[model samples]
Structure formats: structure tokens, C-alpha cells
Target: MNQFIWSFLCGLGEAKYLNRTFVMDLNMCLSGAHTEDGKDVNGKDFRFYFDFEHLKESVPLVEEGDFLKDWHRWDKKKGPGRMTVRKVPTYKVTPMQLKRDKSNIIWRQFDGKEPENYWYRVCEGRAAKVIQRPWYAIWKSKRLMNIVTEIAGRMDWDYDGLHVIRGWKAQNKKMYPNLDADTSPDAIVSKVTKLIKEWRNLYIATNEPFYYYFDKLRSHYHVHLLDDYKELWSNTSEWYNETTAITGGKPVPFDAYMKVIVDTEVFYRSKAKVETFNNLTRDCKDGINTCNL
Candidate 1:
């Protein structure tokens, strides 16, 4: 099950949530929180863990403990592979808002013209971010090392993700670059069009890890969510059955994104809740696992 920690305060320099505490089974979760052990106000029964250290950063430490004086030794990829609040970029996002916005947005597209303000009301007064999970991109390339070169050659923009799989400061620019001179720009563009035609299923909710994911799944891409979701939802006066610019009168979604799935693999960490396979169907949102989305 998913675990979550709430905000509570101890004697000094400590913040804990007495409301609820939880235990986490982090196969790849970044953070988790839940209601405290008991229902009523408790001293320190609530629990929390830093999965960013273990999954993303490879740090390993005790998962359950009191938060007053002890800290876990979870890994941090950016720093000493250690777990710390100062590690992964974090924002104070309300889980209710995230859940409501994500869920209700789909209904607007599913039905027709829900109030535009409805979407904002869910996301407003909430903390959110557009984090670039670069590790996911790198992990993707390593997963598809075999097909990366071929995928590069077919870029409509001729941009190869293989080059910067390690980052912009790759060891050998001569060996790998996102764009290639030999491939005609026209040909690159054509290839992109052709590829998108066949791979539209894989991109709807995806962003940073497109290259490797597209290569493996050969799915079409979708636009990135952060680019304009907030603005579009904020300014809109009416909701529509679909959120795409092609159908909704917005600017064209980005080519690199526009078709990828976003957070296609997140889950609510519930054992009792039955997971639905159809939620993230490619036909629905290009295979975005929306139960987790």
C-alpha cells in the first residue's frame, strides 16, 4: 500500500503531521503520506519516509520511525545519495487538489463543457510544480540502448535523446547529438510525421522520457502538461469534451510532447481499490495509466 506522512512539529527544528501517518512500499514512489496511526490527536504516531532517497537516489534506510529526533539514511541522487528535505525539489501541493483536478479534468473531456472554473477551483490554492525528472530520461535510454541509434536517425527534428542521455555535457558530442546534419531536415520532419502517425498511443501524458519510451513502445506522443494546462484552464470560460488545441481552439500542442502520456504509471497505493486497465488505455489518453495518473 502507499504510505504518506503528515506535518507535525516537535520541540525544535521538527515538523510532523499528527493527522495521519503511513508506511510505504516504494517500488518507485518518490514520497508517501497517510493519516496518523490513530484517528484522534496523537503525540507522534504518524509516520513518513523519503522514497526519493531509495528509488531515485538509491539510498536505503529504515522505513518506519518517529520523526522527532531520528532521520533515515535514504539515498539522494543529487547529493551523497542521502535522504534530506533539501534534496529533491519539492513543493507544498495539496493531495486533494491534485486528485480532484486530475480526476475532474478527464470528465470535462469525457462529457462536454464543464465549467472552466471547476478545473481551476480544484487546482487553485494548491502547490504544484513542473519538475523535470531527468533520471527517468536517462533510465529510459539505458533501457533502450539497443534501439537508441535507430530512433535518433528517424527524428523529424533529427534530435537524438541518446546524445544527452547523460545530460547536455555528454562526454562525446562528436559521437552523439540530438540533431544530425546528414539527415535532411525535410526528411526528419517527414519521419516525425510518419512516426507520429503510428505511435500516437505512447505520448499523451509523457514528457522528459519520450525518446526512450517512444523507442520501446513505438507509441505516439502527447503534449507536456505543464506548458499550458494552468493557463488554459485559468483563462477558459467553458470546458469541452476534449482538451486538445486541434479540437479546443488552443495553440497546437508541441510536437515532441503533444502525444505522450503523462505520469502513465502512478498509483494511489490502495489494495482494496480495484485497478482498472481501461483508465490509461492508449485510445483514452495514449495509454496513460490514469488510475495512477
Candidate 2:
């Protein structure tokens, strides 16, 4: 998902630099790492996780399917030989050099090895200084935002968010020796009590798998987890129905990546936000002893 965002930003930057309408592929493959079943899932619609309408407002864009259809129509009318096309096989062919090329389409092919084939590479080096990534142009799907709004609204928009980065980090003692102990339920209840008032709505944004792991904090605060609002993306929900329609009647699972997006957005809407690295433990985010870096 991180790679997808960066690559999209790079593409958007390229389009802006060339003063051209950006052709975007709405279909995306969700990585295995972010899937619930630990397998890569294909045919995910971009609208499932982002606001395509909002993106269109921010940039001159056309869906890839529409773009291809137009290209084929032109090919039939003028013949394929009449249309000018530039095939870019390497990032070494900088965008700066192709700034004045008279090509109907500048096709970039990432057929090289790992890192080298990365889409963001086109924006590195001198190109980085010229092309700026339009981060504001991309917004999370309003559908997902609806869920975030519903969760916040349920708490009357008055809540304190706690982001506890546990999971592998806590188990990896060599890198985060104190993470497991510091994020323990007992430790969380002890430390959080002093920072937030008792009996307040507390939303815990965590990767902890166990639903009952944060039960210890319930005594003092109304603890809420992402799982508590599963119905928002369930079969009966608007999100599920809309996403299904976009995907031709296929249901979109609320995968782990979607959970993270919702979790982060809800955390942002909170009145007070607490993080694990600095607030709950002394371990560095990257690892131990790297805090000063």
C-alpha cells in the first residue's frame, strides 16, 4: 500500500509536469501482507479505498479503461501507424528529456529488476527538484471516511485515541526490548489513567489481534476497537453495497489495509492522540538506540 501511494504520487507529478491529463488505473491488487488471509488479492477497485471523484477535482484525470477505448478508436480511424507513441523502458530516460516529445502516448514499461523497476524512481535525482508529488490530490475514499465519521459520531466526536504499536514489534525483544512490557494491559491502564480523565471514550488503534487484550482498560474508560464497528463494512452496510456495485456485484472484504486506513483517520479526529514509541515506551520507532537519529 505504501508503494502504491508513492507510485501514484509519482505518476501524478509526472502528469502535472507534462501538462497532460493523467490516465489512472482504477483496478488495483491488494498486497498479501495487508490481506487477512495472507494472500495477494487482485481486481480491487481504486474507488474501494480512495475518493476518485475528489481526485478528479484535484487533477485532470481519465480512467485507464476509458483512455484505452479512446486510443483504440483513434487507431481504427487513423490507423496505428499514424499515432505517435513513445515507449519508455528505463527511468534513465528522464522526464525532463521527454518534456518536448510529440508523442500521443508516453508508455513507461517497468520490466527491469526489483528497485530499478519501481515507479517512483522516475521522480528521483534531478527530476525530484522539478516534479513535486501532489499529496493533497489523493484523498481516502469517502465511503471509508463515512465509516470513520460514523465511529467518531458514535462517540459524539469526543474521544482520546491511543495508538499502541504492538504485534511483531513487541515480540522482537532485540529491537524493542521494552515494547512488550510497556504496552502490557496493566502498564497501559496505569499510564493512561494519569493522562486522560477516567470514564472517557477511549479509542485504541492497535494491531493487537486479541479482542480481549485491552479489556484491562475497560474499568476506567469506554474502550473502543476497530472490530467493534465491523457492521459498517459488513454485507448489509452501504460501503459493502457500493463497493460491490463497482466491482460488478463482487463483495469487497474489509481487509487489514482498510482497517489501518480507518484506524489512522479515526485517530486523527480524536481530541487527544497518544503514540506508543514516545508515550508508552522509550524504544525507538526503527529500533533501540536510534531515538536520537
Candidate 3:
């Protein structure tokens, strides 16, 4: 049997697809009689989890959700820990390989005309069932959920979601000229004010300054930001903080990324989810959001 290392290199936000590819790879390995360079490939040891070392160094933590409940949490010098090898034949798999036609290539690599000397398989796919329930489903982190819930508790009232609507879409003015006009604070307030009745709370998620819309929207709805709960998360997020420190402050980027994930998750769970654009067109003139160029 040929020894191989499977390297899954992708951001946390793309875990859903990554997971699908992972399953496909596992099946391919099984089919090809290639066993992971460790204990039994069918045991819990074969499961994937957040690479804490990578996370501390700048990699974002995996998206929080119930789908990740079984993944082994990485603890420093504890738990199963991350995969460590001085050197090995590595097969690098990426998110692009998860697509339809590209996925076929992955199947071929495992069962086709690849030279036998190749020790690494850097692609994805080859599953009996490509897309399955648990593979595509997302789950939130319990710790993050608790933190966000506690923040909500401070408000003493239920709230609706208000995603401020900025990112690749908002950045491309030439491509999405109307995106700025549509997602402006004034426009958002105008749209949301009419829809929401009884004037309750609005949980805000944005890439811009909170105060920009704070005073204007407060007249009708109590405003909230992911930042408001930072202290709560910081105090209790010992493991995250420790990991952050270990990497010499590089984890700072992930701190913001975590907030975004939390914000998106909270928005999804909200009674009403609101965005700037009635339909944020994935179709962009530059093919930024839609096409993979």
C-alpha cells in the first residue's frame, strides 16, 4: 500500500464544500486500498477538526454549527492534536477541485492513469454519493452560541437581524453601482423602518462603522453590533485567546472573522433576516462574486 498525506487547504467559511470533498476523498482512498498514514481509517481518528495551530497563525476557525459537533477540538499539547509530519508525500486538495468537471479529475487520479510513483493525491471527490445531508449541512459552535445568547439576554427583548451589507459587493462600485445606493444607511433604515412593527431591537452586522447608522436608526429601533459582545466573548474565550497569543497576535484577523461568522449565524437565526439589496446579485460585471476567474 502506498503511504500518502491528504492536505485539505481551504478557509473555514468553505467547510461545507470542503467536507463534501473530504468524504469523496475518503471513499476514493478506501476504493484504491490507500490507507491514511495512521490508525484505522474508519475510526474517529480519521475525522477532521479545526487546526488550532493554523488558526492561531492566521487561519480562520471552522464555521460554528452542529455539523462540527463530532470534530475533535484541538488543544495545545492535548487532544488528538494536529497532523505533524517532518516530511511526507503530500497531495494538496483545494476548493476549486470540488466543482463538477474538476471533481471528475479527482476520481481519475485515484482510479485512472496517474503514474504509480505519485504518492500524494491533491484533488477531491470519488464518493458513491457525492452530496449528502450531513456533508453539506452547517453547525454553529456551542461556545460561540452561548456567547451570542448571553449578549442577547442583556437586551431583555427579542430582536430582528440587520446585516449592514458590505464586502466584495460593496467594494465594486463600477460593477455594483447601485449596491452603494441600495445598502446605504439611509436606504437601509428607510426600508427596515417600514417593515418592522412595534419598534424592537435590530442586531447589526456590517463592515463599516456602527455609529454611522446608530443614531439615525435608534429613533425607531434599538441597535446592536457584534462588537458589543466582544468583552463577553473575550473573557470566556480562553482557548481562542491562548491560541491567538501562541501565534504572536496573528490570530487577530480570525477574531474579526469569528465575529462575522457569529453575526451571520445570529442573523440566520433571527426572526427576520434583512439585507441591503433586495437581491444581492451574485452576477457582477467583473465576475467578482459570481464567476470563478
Alpha-carbon RMSD to native, per candidate: 23.1, 1.7, 14.2
TM-score of 1: 0.20
Candidates' C-alpha lDDT: 0.24, 0.90, 0.47
Estimate the TM-score for candidate 3. 0.50
TM-score of 2: 0.95
Which residue segments of model 1 deviate by more than 4 Å?
1-172, 177-188, 198-226, 231-293
lDDT of 3 by residue, 142-239 (tens): 44556567766776637887776666566777667667666666776677777776478788777664456556788888778877766655534753
Worst 10 residues of 3 by lDDT: 42-51
In candidate 1, what are the lDDT values of residues 137-185, reduced to their tens digit? Answer: 1122121221222222223322211111122212223443322221222
Rank candidates, TM-score, best first: 2, 3, 1
| TM-score per model over all chains | 0.20, 0.95, 0.50
The lDDT, on a scale of 0 to 1, for candidate 1 is 0.24
The stretch of ten residues in a row with the least summed lDDT in candidate 2 is 74-83
